[model samples]
Target chain A: AQTVTQSQPEMSVQEAETVTLSCTYDTSESDYYLFWYKQPPSRQMILVIRQEAYKQQNATENRFSVNFQKAAKSFSLKISDSQLGDAAMYFCAYGRGGSEKLVFGKGTKLTVNP
Target chain B: GAGVSQSPSNKVTEKGKDVELRCDPISGHTALYWYRQRLGQGLEFLIYFQGNSAPDKSGLPSDRFSAERTGESVSTLTIQRTQQEDSAVYLCASSPTGYRNQPQHFGDGTRLSIL
Candidate 1:
């Protein structure tokens, strides 16, 4: 079974600063997908970014990006110019290709200090 | 535009009572999923439905938990004789297809509280 691990239980960053949330996974499959999801106080899970294991280039979305090191099985999310709205619980998820189930990490609570 | 819809944003029920949670997927989405999020924890996959294929019940924790979907439409998750342990936020999501590249859009989960 594939498993995702987020070592940081909580993280804090000042506004306009940068922060990285670390994530690692264990998977035997060569092709898989990794994702970072943010959950606000409203209880809605929002997709922050994603990376495909087969792709060598890291994925970037606006201020959010991921450093995907496939060989190390490490996928970390970096948030630049963070804002107060970015404060939330972030979760890392992994799913193998052709599989419908996604395994999630415990989660990292991010706090943006203004 | 509207996203996935889930009814009764909050549900408080007694132990041993049966409760049904509803989820209306985005129109035309071929895949729908159910997950449970305990407080301060990550989401846990519960069940999945894709197109007309047989639903996947592998993630279901026990026989007490069951779910149903109607031809790429609404899905209902039922918890029979619920236990306090069953209390958690039940979330529903949908994607254009069950493809790996497509990310799942989620609904504000229904917080189920067992009293």
Candidate 2:
């Protein structure tokens, strides 16, 4: 079984500042994918960014990026120029190759102070 | 629907009652999944269905939870003899294929409250 861990339960950042959320996972498979999902107060889950294990280069989508270290089993999310809208519950998810289900972390609540 | 769609945004039921939650995957998706999110908790996998075959059922917390999918389209999650612990948000997701590396698009989720 694969497990994703997000040690931070809650995090806060000043608007326009940068914040990083840490995530680590346990997986034996070499081919897998990691993702960051944001769930706002509206309870809508949205995809923030994703990283493929086979890729050495980290994935960046707009202000969201992931620092993926496959050997260390670590995948962290970095948000630059954080905006008030960035406040939400961010989750780290793992998906092994050829599997449709995703294993998610406990989630970290991000609060942006304007 | 353009994205995975779930029905009855919210549901409240008494204990021992049976509740059904529906999920309609994206048009071209071949894989669908059901997960449960307890208050202030992470997502707990329940079942995974690809086409008509369910490849995994290990994540279901108990036998009270069961889910089924028709072809590659809609799916229904049924909780029999529901308990208070069953209260949570049931989420549905779908991907273009059942491949694990593919990104799964999620629905708004159906909040189920057992009273």
Off by over 4 Å in 1: none
Interface RMSD after interface superposition, each candidate: 1.1, 1.3
lDDT of 1 by residue, A1-114 (tens): 888999999999999999999999999999899999999999889999988888899999999999998889999999999999999999999988998778899999999999
Docking category for candidate 2?
Answer: medium
lDDT of 2 by residue, A11-74 (tens): 9999999999999999899888899999998777899998889999999999998899888999
User: Chain B vs. true chain B: TM-score for each candidate?
Assistant: 0.97, 0.96
List the pairs of residues colliding in candidate 1: none
- What's model 1's TM-score? 0.98
Best by DockQ: 2
- Model 2 lDDT at residue B61: 86
